[model samples]
Target: MLLMLLGTLGVVMSAAGWLSYRAGLQEAGEMFDARLVQSTRVLVSLVDEPLSELNAYPGEPIVLRGWHGEAQGVGEALAFDDGHAYENKLAFQVWDTKQRLLLRSDSAPTTPLAVAEPGFSDVVIEGARWRTFTLRSSNGRWFQSAELADIRQELATDIAGGTLLPLLLALPLMALVIWWSVALATRSLRGLSMEIGQRHPERLVPLDPADVPREAQGLVSAINGLLQRLDVALARERNFVADAAHELRTPISALKVHADNARHAIDEQDRVQSQELLGISIERVERLASQLLSLSRAESLGGARAHSRLDLDALVRTEMEELRPLAERKNQEIQLTLEGAQLWGDEFALGLLVRNLIENALRYTPAGGVIEVRTSSTGTHAVLTVEDSGPGIPEDERERVFDRFYRRLGGGSDGSGLGLAIAAEAVTAHGGRIHLGGAARLGGLVARVELPLDT
Candidate 1:
C-alpha cells in the first residue's frame, strides 16, 4: 500500500512538472510574439515619414530612386538619419507592393521572408528558427522585422531550470510527512502487541477497547470470549475431580474393613486363604486411594502460582527414609544420594512427586534388586532422579506412562497407573519437566525431574 501510494504521487508529480514546462514554453512564445509585433510597428513608423515625403512630390522619380538606393544601404549599414537604428543584432527588410525585395538586413536570409496576412509569423530559413512580423504602410511600401527563435527556447529552458531546486527540496519533506502519518496509524497495533506479549500465561485478561482500533475491535472481542470459555472448562474439570474423589473414598474404605474381617476367620485353612484375599484387597484399596488423590491434585493445581525455594536434596532424603522399610521387605537395597541441590517448587507437591517415582521403581524391580534416588543441581536448574535395577520400560511406552490410567504392556505392578501422571502434573505446575529414560547404573527405568532454580 505504501508503494502504491508513492507510485501514484510520483505519476501525478511528473504530469504536473510536464504541464508546467509546456506552459512556460507557451508563455515564452506568446511574449516573443508580442515583442516582435511591437518592434515591427516602431520600425514601420521610422520608414513611413521618408516614404510619405517621396510620395508627396509626384514626378520626382529621381528622389524616389535615390531613397530606394539609401534604403538598400540602410539594411547593412546600421545608420539612420535620426541616429536610432539598432546597434547590435536586429534583422530588417524592405519590399515593394509587388512583393519584390528592395533591401535586406545583413543577417537576413537570402530567401524572401514568408509573409502571412501582414502579421506575426514563424518561419525557418537555412535550418535556423526566426520570428518575423510584417507591416503594410499607407504608401506602396512594406516593412518586416525578424529575430532568432533561440531566445524563446533559452527562456523556456531557464524557467524549467529554476523550478527544479524547489521540486527537489519538496521530495524529502513530502516523504517525512508520509512516514509520520504511517507511524501514527500503526501506533495502536504496536501497543496491542506489547500488552499481549508481556502478560502471564495464566492471566486471562481481556484487551481494553479504548486502546484498540475500531477495525480490530472484533478480534479483541473474540479473544476475550475464548478466554472466558477456557476459564469455565478449567473450573468444571476441578469440580469433577473433587466429586469423584469424594464418591470413591467410602467404597474403598468399606472394602478394606470387610477384607480385614475375612482374614480374622477361625479355621486355620480358611484363615490362610482369606489372608491372601485380604492382602490383595488392601493393595487394591491403596492403589485406588493414591490414584484418586493424584487425579484430584492434577485437576486442581493449574498454573496459578509460582514455586518457592527449598532444598531438593533434603526433600529426596526424607522420602527415601519412608520407602526404605518397603524396599527392605522385598530384599532390595534403597540408596539415597544427595548433591546439596536447591530448587524452587511447592514442597508438598514435590514430595508427592518423589514418592510416586520411588514407588514406581519399587513396583517394577524384583526382589534383591537395588533402587537409587539422587538429587543434584545443574547451572540454573535442579535435578531429581529415581532408577531401579529391573527390566527397563520400552521407548514406545515412555510417553504413554505419563497419561492417566495408562499402564505399560507386560508390566506387573499393583498400581492404579496414575503415579507418573500425578508426578507429571506436579512438575508441570512448578514449571518443570519429567521424563523416563535409561538408568546410568541400573538397567531399569529412570525417572528424572528438572525444575527452575528461581521462583
Candidate 2:
C-alpha cells in the first residue's frame, strides 16, 4: 500500500514539475525579450550625445572591455569589482540611416548586426546565435541590443531547476509519512487476523468491533454474522448426530434380539413368529430414518426455498396418492376437496409439508375412520387442511406436538414424532403458518397450513 501511494504521488509530481518547467522557460523567454527592448530605449536616450562626440573614432566605436574569458570563476568578477560575468555575453550597436556603424560595444561584431528594420530579430555571427532587439529613436538613430541565445537558455534552465528543487528534496520524507500512516491504519486489521488464526476450532466468538476503523466495520460485521450462523449450524448438526445415535439404538437392539430368537428357534412356528417381530422392528427403523431425512430436508430449506409455480391442490393430490395405501390398509375413507389454488414455493419442500400432515392423520385415525383433505385460497394466501376422525390433541398440548421427537402419551400411533415438526419447518420456511385444532366437521385433529400464494 505504501509503495502504491508513493508511486501515484511520484507520477503526479513528475507531471506537475514538467508543466512548471515549461511555463518557467516560456515566461523567462518573454521577460528576456522585454528586457532587451527596455535596455535599448534607456541606452539610446543616455548614450546618444556622448558617443556623438566620439564620431572621430568611427571604426573604433569606444570599446568597453568586459571579462577576458572563461578562465575566471563566475563570482570572481563581481567580488573584485570588475564586471559581472554575463557582461561579455551582452552587446549593443548604433547605426545611422545609411547603415553605417556609428558606435558599437567591444563584444559586438564589426559588421551590421541586423537588417535596418524595427522590433526583434535573431541573427547568427561566427557560428554563435544571438537574439537582438532594434529600436529607432525619434532622431532616427537605430539602437540595437543583443545577447547570446545560449545564455538566455541556460538562465531559463537554472530558474526552472531552482523552482522544483525543494519538492525533490521533500519526496523521501513524504513517502516515510505515508508509510507510517498506512501501517497505523491497518494495525487493528492485522491484530484481528492473528486473533482468528490462533483460535480453537470450536471457538467461534465474534471479534470486538470497538477498535475497528469505520471503513472496515462492515467487513468485521459481516464476518461476525457468518460466524454466528456457522455456530448455529454446527450446534444443530451435533444435536442431530446425538439424537440419531439415541434413536437408532433401541430398534437395532430389538432387531438383534429377534434375529437371535429366530435363529435359535427349534420349531417352524416359533421361527416364523420371531421373523415377523424382526420385520416389525426393521419397518420401525426404516420409518425413523425416513422421518429424520424429511426433518433435515425441511430445516435445510430455511433460506433457500425455490421460486417455482405450483398448484397447491395438485401438489396435495400427489402427496395423498403416495400415502393412499396407508389409509386403505386401515379402511379409512379419504374425502378430498381440492380447489385449483396456485402457489409459488419450493415444490419438494411443500410436498414434505403436505405428506407429513396427511400421513399423520392417516396413522392416528381409527380403523374405518374418515379423513377429509381440503385446499382453498383467499386473495393473498393459500391454505391446506387435513382433518381426521381421531382423538384430537388437547388445546394445552397443541403447540408441543410441533416439537421434534414430541408425542402425546397413549396415542397408540407408530409415529416417530417428527412428522408435524417437519410440517412446521416447511411452513415456516415458506413464511407461512400452521395451526392444530379440533375439526368441527371431522370431529378430530385438523392440521391446517396457511401459505402466501406469492411467497
For this target, which candidate reaches the highest TM-score against the unseen true structure? 2
Encode model 2's per-residue lDDT on 331-421: one tens digit a residue. 9999999887888999888999989889999999999999999999998999898999998899999999998888789997868888999
- Model 2 stretches with alpha carbons more than 4 Å out: 46-63, 69-80, 95-103, 109-116, 122-129, 137-143, 150-156
Count of backbone collisions within predicted model 2: 0
Model 1 stretches with alpha carbons more than 4 Å out: 1-267
Q: Note the residue pairs that clash in candidate 1.
A: none
**Native RMSD of candidate 2 (Å):** 3.1
lDDT of 1 by residue, 1-455 (tens): 55666677778777766776677889998987887778778867876667556534333121111122222233347456644234223477767676656556666654566663588777888887778888887776777778777767666766775675476578778777887887787789788888889988777767787877788889889888887877776676766566557646755676667576676777887777777767777767766776666666765676645447788877888887888887888999888888999976678788888888998898789999999888888888889888899888888889988877676767876566778878988888888888899887788888888888884
Which lDDT values do the candidates have, in the order given? 0.74, 0.86
Q: What is the C-alpha RMSD of each candidate to the true structure, in Å?
A: 18.2, 3.1
